[model samples]
Target: METVVMRVEELQLGKIVAEDIFANTQYPIIYKNAKIIHEHFRIFEMFNLKEILIYKEKKLEVLTEKQIEVETTIIKLSNYTSFETDYYDAIAQIKREFGNWQAGAKIDITKVRGMIIPLIEKVLEDRSYIFDLNSYSNAKDYLFHHCIATGLIASIISKKLGHDRGTIIQVAIAGMLADSGMAKVAPRIRDKQSALTEIEFAEVRQHPYYSYLLVKDLPALKEVMKVAIYQHHERLNGSGYPKGEKMSSITNFAQIIAVADVFHAMISERLYRLKQSPFKVIEMIKEEEFGKFDAQVVQALVDIVVDLPIGTKIELSNLELGEVMFINKYAPTRPLVKLINSGDIIDLAANRNFYISRVITKEY
Candidate 1:
């Protein structure tokens, strides 16, 4: 870690002091190893301190440079353990359930709940599992990864919105079953790489209705659950197919699923296209899909994503590597990275050419 007297103009967010930064006033201590946030820039100047001793990286984060080795081991353990355990089976079941629905078997709400509840409990009890959700995205079968990621994402966003356990559980349940009706469409069309013809697009739009029909008759489902299934594809702009309902007509549960679905779809690899970076996708959701989706839901998703712990190793698009020095609230995908070889700190947001290509520990 470097210690230097940096001018006020050079200070940026998340700069931590190596030694105590004294002020003129009555405050007890501007203690050593204390981290500065966005609000502290003014506090430094208020005290009339023009320069302060700062470190190359903050010391207060739960993660540390020394601890990164252990965290990497833990991540490697997680991938193997989760793959062998029921985690893989849970996603496998989602795929099977979709096939069962298409085969004229009824929607088994009890079985679906049994599959979703354990995962929801895992994420709820430990929020760090949110980071693992992206790792769980696999390309072997889109629906398997899609449904599982959808549920985990739903619970996270639901809890962000302050929904109770019951609601969160239900949203999780709805998430797993949200796209089940895709089974009704021919696999060839669903996996088509090219733009769909008008007829194919029309067929694709019916999946939500098909999903609604499968779940609507299940007495085990709550009203909100059924509605989430039905309306997940409906947009506020009246551009969505089936009913083409507007903003006021859609329920909040559906809005949550809609956001999660779009996010999972974009991140997970598909036959049609390559996956985009999560940060870029989030930017698109906000900038392009404005009136088409609920803003609150999108913000909740963004809030949940930017919590990437410090010390995480990340890869850039050009194949260079770096470790996360700090998380920037203004831009998440573009966190402060201290390059391993150069020891130079980079603010990813400032450098537009380099976007985080992957989270090394979190992805294979």
Candidate 2:
């Protein structure tokens, strides 16, 4: 009998592999034509097995579950599909409340916090899909894309740092509301076309302080809420405002929020500036601003961005178009690509090889 196996993405469409049916009885099935899809299907079925063998090419052995827990965490991120509408409404409401906090009486920070926690857990359960911040739009949609993105990043970082559930939630909540003050800023300044003057910048910096004040009076929110509101802007270099806090003074929870905030801001398209490419932003964070961010946290973000599937169409450097096929973790900017019209994957990581030169520009 011919052995059959399916790809991970195909599992969602109900694809089946007849020959691999018997393999299901065993833990960690191996197949010559195995795909990550089989492992995902197994996960969807809630099978508590580890590892799946996809295929072996020359010296390369494709094992699907080395970091099984991490991979599983990534796969569960798809749950956001169900909560998109709720997220959208939550953001819209938050934005509106910021515009006129009195219009809605008092903003229900506790209620909003409750709604977002589960979403964060879902993303934590599946880190892979959720970490693909580049593919998501950061527009002014009512959806919780930003919250979800921040939550995912926070969860990943929290897990890496061995943070407990309570700590993780605190970080996630901070991430969700990091921009709550944006609503308080004048609409024109928030939506300005050109760079802001020193005054405008100062006003923007006041957001974190304003957010802190907004929640300072709530007893239930005294602990977690204040952290989220205040620390989102405190940076490592003491350059961040409201307070010029250095890394030593910054809380770990606050640091996580800062990374999430910066990452989301870079990937998201704003009214004044076009979105910065994820890989490019990662590189920038690593170089001149090295100590400004936690090195491990930045690496986690880079790993997530570099591993995006090859068939994903992306706007590239010099206005050329290509689809990512393979990622060079060491050099994310130069991933292997297959031109839109071409059929082969070009490994840009190969030095002086016939690969597309330059990085993916932010013009798109």
Candidate 3:
């Protein structure tokens, strides 16, 4: 029988695989001639497999009609909401849920999945949304916004790290809920505008444990996800809270959320602290905070920020406008830039006093 290459998104139910599919495992993930089932979609996404060979159906007439429907879903971009709208709406939902949690309500996992899954899908569609997460945040709604953005950031980082779609979504959820335990803390402590007292700080640090309690009984959540929620605050160097877990004890999933949580928290504005530039914050995470995080997870975030295309407009720490002219392989963050006003090319690697403050425009 003749076979045709099909995009994984276009593959219909019951289609026969034309060849074995391997995702670097010792054995094939999907055997040749096996029928495609609903579960296989996740396997394909997990492996990031774009296209696969499938035997042509005996009835070409029915196949064409089915393929058209699949193609329509694939090509349609209008179905999704704008990233910002979906994002803020999710924040609002999380705010409500946090209130519910404070009122002694049980977690409604279905509702969380509904609000977050779309935001994740939209963000995954346009990876640039990750860059602007900090700008969308405010001090008043910082906690709510952080939860949603952390989930989105975690999802993208997980994707970059080559995790399956399901696992990526789980990591996003875990990252968002990592701080949910704060709802269990005293309101005065959580809402305090000034510095937290050492006693208050100690109580606040138990949020991760509270978070684990909130979701421990959830059957929909995997056991590893529950552990990640509890361990998101746990650092690789054993400096983190709840439990002082070292490198060997921490799970990769927890580390993904940990990096995402810190990245969003530092770049975002809060009552007690000023928001730092994303570029500057990333530098601190990679250098100053090096030993506390997983190297692979930190590198994934670095690649997302530093691997910018030339001609991307940006602002420097000195309030000067410029566009990226070239990227230095060694110091990806410190690229050569052309000053928008002065028309002079300065290599940021050599110019230690200046650094990227924010990306103005991504388009060339």
Candidate 4:
């Protein structure tokens, strides 16, 4: 038997494991040679397996030849985005960790810190992968996908704010688990495709409190982190929930997580609604009418992410298409763009009337 190293993301759904996979911890033998499933990736990530051996000999009737060719191309090119891999593996680990927490597994603060710090570093080094992963998240569960995105977005904001690594990691963990309360809600309600009744909506709003209770007594986890998780839903202007605490009353950590959570949630796909484009969401966040988030935190996020999808085509408020040309540091949300039709350069920062409606496509 021959084997090749393949990242879990690179694994084809119909592929077979060429060798046994193992976890370094208590659950050592993950599985023997078997067909792969999406859940397998979560298990692989718990122990941080970068690559697994897969039996490439089996033909995948499920996938078209072109799909297989593209997979092979990605592998052969060695086109690695280490950050992207880290970002995904983080989600996988969260699935396992959160499952444990909900199933009466004690919140092991030391273990969680160990698992999440590396994940934060991956995003701090580069946050573009959050957008990349979100795009690929069409098939991912909203809960898992949004948790990881919140974690990544929070850490990126922390990095932009010049927080020390220790502080940043704390915020990342809080962001990752901020909505753990949602796990306690009935799946039927949580997964509902239509608007919830007022009673149902009230239940939905209790999630922050549930998350708070879950981690409140973990001796190893900082009190600050617990507070952040509890208050992540609160707003600066006191419009948010659980407890409508005002801006000055909220901790800075909680404030940062709040901003990240909303941004990631809106940009991510949900069963009930289509996901908003990154540009459009960011624009909404920056507008005066939606000015509930911490101004500094929002700008920090804007500074880090605005010019991120460079070279992507964007639609304007008036529906004209233009290619993003350059970023103006003064106006991170708007960039220098050239009209697709006229080839004329427009500085979006200079023209307040013109703003990106939505990003058409990312360069990657």
Candidate 5:
């Protein structure tokens, strides 16, 4: 029988696997010709069995035995510990403060360090586990995700520079609270989809200063913590807001937060525009704003996203579905992909026969 390849999108849920869909995971032949209505499906759940052999032909053909590999790769990638229970609790408290910022409820700046430090240590220890906050689909979840991502990135940088644990935690807290001033802005203005007028942009730029002023007088959070609220927006080229201080004047802690903040914002889908894919965003950072960010820090981030695992589903330039099987670490934009229907894994990095035109959707 001539082998026929089918895209996962083209295959129905009930369609029997003409061949072993994968070595470890397999589906029953009864699903042959079954239509798939949803874009996302758990292969294990759909099979109703842990593993089975599947054939790709029109009829059922058991090719080989299979096993379901239970691995918490994502969870294990980050060094999660039960010790951070209090940290998680602190974030919930901070979120509550954000809800009542208008009623004169102040964010507990001292408590911020406790929650942010361990998260940063985890990010530094295991680069793979830094969740991309910008990848979230819902705008309502952005605030929490942003805080997490920021803390993770900041902590990684601090550890790289050999900062002590106490100092690293303080810096991470700064990164987490960098955008606290946004709470003061009206939801309508912050969530507007259209281009902001000059007045609006000015108001947006004042958030860092406003945040600094709000907590600058607190004795517990007087000096170091203020950096988190004030200097986050400052850039090395003096293009950033408030005082327009040059890069030399910004603290190393603040610089790390700035990089993380910009990265999260660029990749995150926003009301005003679609989010850029991780590779594309990294490219823009390297080409257009290299001077604005620490080169070592940016390179570390680039390395993390470029080497994401194979079998990861991604949106392609043609609005088709595919999985990453290989990556050209040197040129991350061009990666080897296996088209869902074709099951043909093409190595764009080597074949030179095809090119990845563009990225349609990012892998979360």
Candidate 6:
């Protein structure tokens, strides 16, 4: 049978696989001759299958000329927009739920799980989504965006840390709800544009305990997750709030959420602070906030960002376009970049001024 190499984003329903697809697993992810369906999109993304060999539709020739054109158009129209569409929808839902929680409603674990599960699944399938999450957020809705992005980042970290599927989902939910207690705080404090007074900051710091209280009674949530939600704000050097607990006292899961939470918050555009590049933020987490986070968790994040393959398109902090040529082993974030305009190779490690601002392409 004849087959065509089609980009995964351009795939539509009912295309038959022409060859087996593998992604570092022992067996093929999708067997040859298998027909594609809606779920296959996530699988394709999960494996980062950019293009696949698929058997061409012989049935198209049997249809009318106009019908054949429509079929081709349909195939062209199908793309990777579903994840973004679902993400915005989830954000809107989270905003509504946060309002409900602020209005004295009970914590809805089931609803919260429903909101993040699909999103988690999608991001897990294609982690590149997590790197671009900050773009989806705005200052006005920073709180809502932070909750969702934190969950997604946590799920990625947990997965990288070798957590099982169930635990990863739980961690993601916990990350999303870690700040849920902020709902209980007065709106004047939660939504304030200016800096908070010591009195108000103290009130804000109580959010962790309040978050724990909100989820403590939920039997569906695991005990570890409850603890993680409560302690996510706690730092490693005994400086964290609600309980100022140090190294050995903190759960590893909580640290995972903590790194994820801080990473998203720092990288995201907030009401008071300008957003920093993800690469720069990762550097700060390692060098500046050294003793505040778990080493393993921070390394996991570094691996996630600096694992950029050679030839990946990136935008530098100076608004220059370049393609990564080499990743410095010791300082992976500062790689060798060949500027697009000058066609000159600039070693970022030597030139400390510019850093990778963001990835421009969808896939590395």
Q: Which candidate achieves the best TM-score against the true structure?
A: 6
TM-score of each: 0.75, 0.65, 0.77, 0.68, 0.62, 0.78
Best by lDDT: 6
**Residue 195 lDDT in model 4?**
85
Candidate 2 residue lDDT tens string, 1-364: 3323434443322222333322232222223333344234533333333333233243433444454434332223244555555555555655555556533345576766766776676556555544345455565541245655675577667766777787777677666666665666777776676899999988988878766666666665547547756877777887776778887677767777778777776767765566666666766677856777767667766665565543445655445577654445457666656677655445555633333322332233
**In candidate 3, what residue range of length 10 has the lowest lDDT sum?**
71-80
- lDDT per residue for candidate 1 within 148-222, as digits (tens), equals 778778888999999998889889888878888888889888877689999999999899888888888887778
The digit string of per-residue lDDT tens for model 6 on 24-122 reads 543455678876755467556544679999888986323454543443311111224887888999899999998998888888888998899988988
lDDT of each: 0.74, 0.58, 0.83, 0.71, 0.61, 0.84
Ranking by TM-score: 6, 3, 1, 4, 2, 5
CA lDDT, candidate 2, residue 212: 69
Residue pairs clashing, model 6: 46-125
Candidate 1 residue spans exceeding 4 A from truth: 1-80, 126-140, 191-194, 362-364
- Candidate 5, residue 146: the lDDT equals 73
Judging by TM-score, tell me the better candidate of 2 and 3. 3
Q: How many pairs of residues in model 1 come into backbone collision?
A: 0
* Model 2 ranges with Cα > 4 A deviation: 1-80, 100-105, 128-152, 222-225, 307-329, 337-341, 350-364
**What's the lDDT of the predicted structure labeled candidate 3?**
0.83
Q: Give per-residue lDDT, candidate 5, residue 216.
A: 73
Residue 320, candidate 5: Cα error in Å is 6.4
Q: Model 2, residue 13: what's the lDDT?
A: 23
lDDT for predicted candidate 4 compared with the true structure: 0.71
- Expressed as tens digits, the lDDT of each residue in 152-191 for candidate 5 is 6777666666778777776677777778787887777676
Worst 10 residues of 1 by lDDT: 71-80
- Model 5 lDDT on a 0 to 1 scale: 0.61
TM-score of 4: 0.68
Model 4, 186-303: lDDT tens per residue? 7778878788999999999999998888788876668988998998888888988888998688888998998888887777777767776676678778884265887888888776
